[model samples]
Target chain A: MRAVALGDQTTYDAGTLTVSSAEAAALVADPALAEVRVSWASPGDSTRIVKVLDAVEPRTKGPGGGGIFPGFVGPAMPQGRGTTHVLRGTAVVTAGFLPRAQEAVVDMSGPAAPLSPLGTTHNLVVEFAPAPGAAWEAVYEALRNGSLALAARLAEAALGATPDAVEELPGLPDAGDRSLPRVAAITNLQTQGTFKEIFVYGRSFGSIALPTLIDPGDLDDGAVVSGQLGHPSLKNPTWVFQNHPVVAALRARHGVDLLCAGVVLSPEPVDATNKELVSAHAARLCKAAGFDAVIVTKEGGGNADADMALKMDALEELGIPTVALYAEMAGADGTGPSIVVPPTKATAMVSTGNYDERLSLPAMERALGGDRVDVAAATALDAFELPAAVVYASLSPLGWGHLTCQEAS
Target chain B: MTTRVVHYINQFFAGLGGEDTATVPPASKAGAAGPGRKLAQLLGDDFEIVATVWCGDDHAAGPEVMDDLLALVRAAGPDVVVTGPAFTSGRYGLACARVAAAAAAEGIAAVACMHPDNPGIDEAGTAPVVASGEVARQMGPSLETLAAAVRKVAAGEPLGADDGRVGKIPRRNVTVDRTSAERAVALVLARLGGDREATEVPLPRFDQVTPAQPVTDVTTALVALVTEGALVPDANPDSLESARATRWLRYSLDGRDVLPAGEFRSVHGGFSTVWANEDPHRIVPLDAARQLEAEGAIGKLHGEYLVTAGNGTSVGNARRFGVEWAADLRRQGVQAALLTAT
Candidate 1:
């Protein structure tokens, strides 16, 4: 994977692509959308973006391959084996007001500026307004389509530019050094049906029959796309899947201290019966893969916690050691138990801090996406105290960020 | 500018006789008394023992005496309050803990010293505490420990492991050098190599509740509606938080036949509330429950519904809310409840 800068230019200049707001609007024009507005937010700028839908990295597959975000932007074809051009330090952010959407705020400059990937990146935000009386399903489809289209277009500018740096991702082999621990990564994606489903190769994960195995390389090439309306702090989004930290860590240590087995995608079913079935199936696959240990992460909370608990029980019961990564719901004052479902066997875990810890966001000079803050109460986006739950990927269980919980007296 | 320190002790420590003075009321001295002299010496000229408040162990345990002792300590306007080196005396330990806890509640920095297993330690509130030996012979070392803790507390420094304090403290949010992902990997490797302490979050003990007996006859049972779905009026008149809610609210349903779609909506932030907004009954089920009431399936329906946002709610807060809700239900003579959790 090679990355280049998105330099400002009407066309591809140096490594950057400069497109006016008009040009950006033209690229993602859809009948379902009433209006499309383009804006820019760079690090250290006094900008706050509310109602954030999802953030996507700009990447494109080189000749003779499917485009970025396979299944959504292009054909759901096999990827992970060819040259891919990525736009580093850049993101295509989709923002809008959805009736049931969870709040996701990105502060360009504040105490929370460095807590989220969206805050650090040079984001090109696409704000969409639904056509009057438009069906929510159609509006959501338009949002996804428009965001992916913009991301693909930005990555296309990186083509023919001098490569800045390239990362050679490690491949999963059948077996490795027996002396080293063999480990795999299993994550549950939000599968609460339409509008809250995570798409794998352009398909809803909820529709998948069983736990599925996919290459780490495919995950980087956009095999997973987030359409979840769950808590913003926990949802993977598209960019998180594209730059999965757990997978990166495992792959980075492959052959050194451990062997990276493979990545498994599990569904976070809402019901107890399906949750049990899915967790059992996921553990079965891990056992069949002959993994010595596994690193687990989950999407959202509540039901996801149950799914994680079931998986841990199943895996531990089979004599497989596992480490689960998750965020605690320790309330605002931080005087509460963090975990919801107490693990019966899998005791090893990593906490991504307290998602319910409130953070006071400084008043921004500029607010984008909407005028009012997206919360249960009515308030302006200029300034407010909100829980980390509303911050984009701040408490992601995948552990991409630095927020953590510590015991104190 | 020295830090003003207020020291508190029991009747015996004040040299006022042992069991005979057990009922003596709280009294105050202008300067260092008992262990305060040692604390003052150890804390040096940087900290001054502005006042010393002493009380009978038995009297201090009473609420009225606690208020009087707290008044004396507050009047001193000390920078920080230090209590005990109570050793193993149960009554003295309790008195010290209560005084420190009271002072701390008024936004004053406070620290208490006692044996680690002292029963009174439970009342120490959020103030930092130093641990002493089990008997009075360890007074010298105990005062030394309390003196150091006093310095730190006065200087606004956090008490750490080396401070000789009891553990099981509160959990705070902090940013670490490594991401959770990196930590998870490192922990997994450690555990695989036979390290049992690799778990970052130890599994907490959960509470198990005995089931309530089913009502013998629903025709005479008083049914009530309870939900964690965060259902509230459209205006959110009470302003219930969307997530991590600390309070639960009750709304009257005396005359309403159904929870209209636009009139009532879910304020929960965990799951998508779209369906609930389109039809509020999906979460609260007030409509169906009302229908059941009309069909004589139950003797009577409770006139009010209780609600709170369950999203990201801490277990402790959840338990607190449940206890209060249950108490209210019991007081209102509600026999059976249908709770809807999202």
Candidate 2:
């Protein structure tokens, strides 16, 4: 937990992080939130978010199991090792009324906001309302405890904070370099729930039945989390399941180039008897965690790619060697048929792009939440026609980014 | 700007009058009219034919003469069109794969040649096509694989089977940017030292359908109740979207039998809607289908159900929603559909 890149008027002792309007109406005091609006945004702002209900990255629960989002609330701890600060150049997002009908947009600046990774940090923009007869499971538990009580009151200004930058990633201590290469990973979530869910510590990983495993120190802080209301650019929120860039690039290249061996998670089956009961117990927990090579990923891109091609054909029918990645709607002129069930021994694969390729942004002097652009106020004036999935928090089902490939156009 | 190709031969490679003008009709002329002057002399100085067209394998075998040779090769705008090495004339190789699939549905970047048992090589869809060689001494290696696939479709690229010397036309694999953990650690160091790779998704053909013809005795069937899972009501009053949905909702079990939870829910985000939003028939079951239609074992049901959230949907939009929900349940007569999915 380090994430410290705060600048442009952000403060964690390093000064300045206000939000006015009676402190955003007393920071989500939850009467199941009758109204809330917050706002902050930084890093090249012409502002232009819309309906995007989730975009986290504000982290702050210092010291192990401090539980900010571990399994979604209160006590379910088990995060990967100790301490956590990460306001890593900020982000909160949330966006107008939403308990489920998903969102992710992030254009903060123009030219497609540097292709959105929440347009390079520093953002807050919440906007909420629910209470006039609440109950959408209490408006999704008051927008998930009012967006984790506003990222723990802006991580209470990083109290005595330290981090300025640090991302080591640990996890090895043992396998004592048996010539590296054990590498594991699985993932394929989207427990198929009311909102393509996943939450694990705070419960509801579709009431789990098997393929679980996950212990890279309970993903180092948030024992797994996400609203990931599928397809808003291939959803995996909860700050990309607590910063999972392939599990922090396998804990920053674990025992060196391989020996990582940590995740499995699974779920995403939905028939063929729960895809042979979770790809044969995740290919027998990747050969009882001995693993020679695995890496799966995938979450929401039609038929969860037949549950990651049934755990890459049950780990290549046992000869091990797998690797999947996944995504791809590929239609909308990307020439359709990107993939649906696959796994006839999934030969390598990566993809993560073309979830209907389309985008047309330009105008924006600022507009978040209740976004107005009913089209034509622009065309002759500024130009708007946006929303064609090029990062409404999308298509990166964790294979991070960069996709081009229409055979490299 | 040089590239305007458009060739498409026939009528004895446009010298006309073969088999009594093979039934005449379709036409077009200006520029490279015969064998398109050897594909504009092997596309030297980069492609210029401009127009050739010629019809008549018995007048392009009907469909009103293939819409008059696709309106004279789409009025020859041509950035690439090409059409015929049609060698083993199975009706001029299915009329040069239907004028290179009607100049690729009008976006125009066709290719087509012929012979791989030419029934127009399975009606040339991804458009590439080349193979040629059952007659006329393989017309100079099928016009040099149609001048290197019309120079990779005039530089816009995307002709498939990845350059195995251009015999392509299978396409739809596309998704290759490396990092399936760097191809699973280079396929586990080439399969733990044995070797053999290539699997980037090539194993799905599932698409089955055949079911119908069952309800013979379900108490005089009419059945109905479908789902892609987005149940409805409960404020979803057509708000729908529970995941790449593409609108389907239908609701109304009219005089109802169950599904009540503050009046229905589960707008499907794939699953776990609190046991179908607290027993909304655990997924539109309509109370075990009205308790098997009050034990008559079933006979009525069809009171508007349908739905549609198959999560990230799209297996070609779930086969165009099973061909528009089997043509709107065969125009609402239904007969049987139970269908339910999480």
Candidate 1 per-residue lDDT, tens place, A296-369, comes to: 89988766788788888899888788888878876665545578886787888898988877888888788887
Interface RMSD of each: 2.3, 11.9
Please, what are the lDDT tens digits per residue for candidate 1 over residues B199-309? 767676554555679899998889999999999999999989887677899999999889999999888876767888999999888888888889999988999999999
DockQ of each: 0.42, 0.09
Docking class of predicted structure 1: acceptable
Please write out the lDDT profile of model 2 over residues A1-409, one tens digit for every residue.
2133334333455544554445545655577767776776676777777667566665656533356666555477666665666666566767764545544567767666655567777777777777787676566656655676577557656656666676666664354456777776787767766555777787767724688776666665666666555567766666667777776666666766666777878777566787777788889877876777777877666667777777788888887877676666644544335667777755766665566555667776777676453322332125555434525654566765544334332
How does model 2 fare in lDDT? 0.66
> What's the C-alpha lDDT at position A281 in model 1?
87
Clashes of each: 3, 14
Q: Please, what are the lDDT tens digits per residue for candidate 2 over residues B1-342?
A: 588887888888788777666767788887887667877888887668878887767556433477778788778788888888887565676667667766787778887877655444444545667666778676887787778778888898766554322332233323355533444445445555655454443333443455667677778777888887787888887677666555475667878887778677786755557768777777788878888888888887788788887876545445545545654565456778878877
TM-score, one value per model:
0.79, 0.34
- Evaluated at residue B135, the lDDT of candidate 1 is 91
lDDT, candidate 1, at B42: 91
- In order, the candidates keep a fraction of the true contacts of 0.74, 0.20
